[model samples]
Target: MAATVEYDVMMAPEEPERSEEEREREAETCKEKGNVFYAQKDYNEAYNYYTKAIDWSQKNASYYGNRAATLMMLAKYREALEDAQQSVRLDDTFVKGHHREGKCHLLLGNAMAATRCFQKVVELETKNEQARKELKNAAAVLEYERIAEVDFEKRDFRKVVFCMDRALELAPACHRFKILKAECLALLGRYPDAQSVASDILRMDSTNADALYVRGLCLYYEDCIEKAVQFFVQALKMAPDHQKARLACRNAKALKAKKEEGNQAFKDGNFELAHRLYSEALNIDPNNIKTNAKLYCNRGTVNAKLKNVCKAIEDCTNAVKLDETYIKAYLRRAQCYTDTEQYEEAVRDYEKVYQTESTKEHKQLLKNAQLELKKSKRKDYYKILGVDKNASEDEIKKAYRKRALMHHPDRHSGATTEVQKEEEKKFKEVGEAFTILSDPKKKARYDSGQDLDEDGMNMGDFDANNIFKAFFSGPGGFSFEASGPGNFFFQFG
Candidate 1:
């Protein structure tokens, strides 16, 4: 059995108290050490010392504020935010604490929260220039981010540049802004400018993954394929999971291979094969402006070689749509229309080429188009059919039948109903002209320059195909396909 000994409760004397002044003195020593570390840019060490000072004197707002700034420098943004909030909580009138909190939020990528903190700082201290500056910066960053995201989603590279420029003006030191600006410039085909921007970013932060990625894109655009691959490799080294860098590297390598293949094909005079290779490159990167433009222009040339004038015009039109300032597209489209005897459309495209091009060759092209337009308008149908003005009646009938069968609407079914109608009208006109010329009496009258409707053919007899063949195919010998829209000519003609 253990004896229960009664033990007297000994009351301990009150622990020695620290005077507020002594606590403050100890806090000052910690603060001084923090400032030394901060000046040396040892932000983590500075943060530790400043936090120690705050713990020593919980009521000192300045200690908490300084610690928050050090935490921000260390990129411990959430912790810095808490410390700054505590600072302002301890002394709500402290303008510096509010400003520090805003900075922490900004570093944390919480622009709206930063904005609120800055607004509060400005409200409490209207004349705090630093707070006002921070507020303006935060607002600009927020607006820029919003606009850039919207424009990027819309594929509006021009508006992206506008928004990113505003952001750069506000946050000149922001790597994110610089990267976005470079991307916009690349999209706009300002390769040289994009390269310069990317280089500047790399110079400032050599290990920056985004900067390396963007520099790779610029190099790829500039046709420096090998160098571009190196840049992407470096970016991957910095951030192994960078999807954009990996994609860019793969695309650049593919483009280089495709370009080589296309060049060889072009040199071998295999225009169709060359066009196919260029198309493949474009498919790898649809936004590749240079490749797309080149493909359009080259495809137009191939279509022309294949004697597909309308297809050539379509290809050239696509080129121009991809890049409105494509002078080659305008010129090629004009040539296609001219070859097809579409003089009015040719004139419009020629005018566009003239507006964009300053070369002497382009001036000559414009002059040639104008002259051709005038000549085409004056071509006579009778001269094109190659019949004598005074052939015998039997000979005239023979010639009319031969010409009608040769230029018959059944040969060109793809023409529109209007075109078929025009061809029929032309055929009737030729028949009537032959009837008048073939008759000895009527021929004599016509020879004397007298107006005579000798055939007496009614409007119903003058079919549309005759008119269209005489008007369009008369001079240029134009023809339509046999299986397309205007195949109604088989029933009527």
Candidate 2:
């Protein structure tokens, strides 16, 4: 209603260079020409002449009504209503003006207003059966429309339909009533019926934003979110400030676009890009609970892809909190747990997913979790180092030195590519064992159901030269004696 333009006196009259009588004569001439054009079926030209006549003499009630009739022919009901009301305001005795105003009100779906206008027309022209009949019909529609509005405000959409049915019976061709009925049906989850009504309205006026919005809602309810967004966008194009359409369009377009970008990036092995895009989707509608849950689940996948096991578990946990029934959340969280070696937690998650979806893949994942749990429970560091648990510090050191040298990358400098890769893996394993055995605190932690490779100094701790130094050193270690050899020469003393 606020969007309806106020058509106040639209024209400004020129200065009175001529006499008042002469101006009235000029106005009459314009009005005659407007009548000529109206008879010729040139409503646009007729409207221009009427406008000029009104500009010449603002007090001509007939000029206002004539222009209003022309506006009606052009289907500008709101403007016609304004002009007709203006004509009646200027001359209360104008029966044709009242009749035109009532027709405008009827077309605008203001039943009570149409009733009042027709009532006035009947009072001005007794024995007018047309006015009598229209007034009675408008009154019935007004009553039904009142109840429908009250039901709508109460959120009683079924009763809203009940009232609208009677109103439409009295005024079946009213698009406003039909559109209202469609909206009520959509609220009641009758999407197909709502779309049917909207389609009917569109057949009458394809540019009806309300009809477009109803169609969009039907699509949204049917789970065609992307297609629904197009309808919402079209409605918004016509009525930019339609709040519901704007919000729906924004949510659908943003979510779908970001998800598509993320999927493509994930396919192309651009994990960082995928992560960023999914994050943007979450930001678009943070308060959309179900959608946010899905976004969190997808972002968890991205984190898992990027090797962020802890972050992935956290994201999936957040998703589960939003929607506990989300199977993918449990599945993704379990995978992260398995990757991080928290196999018991992984087993619980896989079981959660398997309970709902017991397919071969789910069963295989559960089996994988069970095997990993066993592996995690009994890792043998001493065995990997080729030493007994009771080995002394010196004995452990000698064993580690031998193992590390055998698997070191430099020790296999001329080896094949596959051999070098295998050596690197062995070197990492040996280094992890050495790190655990070398640190008493870490060794105690490992013995107490917790072991971590992150605690180790790893490959950065020693280069080939350092390994050679360790190799050449005595039990008490070696000191360099520069006087025993040439300048800067290494010596074991």
Q: How many steric clashes between backbone atoms does each model show?
A: 22, 0
lDDT by residue (tens digit), candidate 1, 1-493? 9999999999999878889998899999999999999999999889889988977899989998898888777756678789899999999989889888888777645678888988998899778788878887788789889989998989898899988787766555556777888888987889888878888878867999998888888777666779989999999999999998999999888888887898788779897897788678668877766656767787788778878788888888888888888888888888888888788888888778777776788788777777667656642334434665445566665666567665565754568989877766565556555545555776665454433444454434555455445534544345544565545333222
Candidate 2 backbone collisions, by pair: none
In candidate 2, clashing pairs total 0
Output the number of the TM-score-best candidate: 1
Model 2 scores a TM of 0.41
- TM-scores of the candidates are 0.56, 0.41
Q: Please report, as a residue range, the 10-residue window in candidate 1 with the lowest summed lDDT.
A: 484-493
Cα misplacement distance, residue 477 of candidate 1 (Å): 30
RMSD of each candidate?
16.8, 20.9
lDDT of every predicted structure (CA atoms): 0.76, 0.82
Give the runs in model 1 whose Cα sits over 4 Å from its true position.
Answer: 1-98, 104-151, 154-172, 190-197, 219-227, 381-383, 386-493
Candidate 2 structure lDDT: 0.82
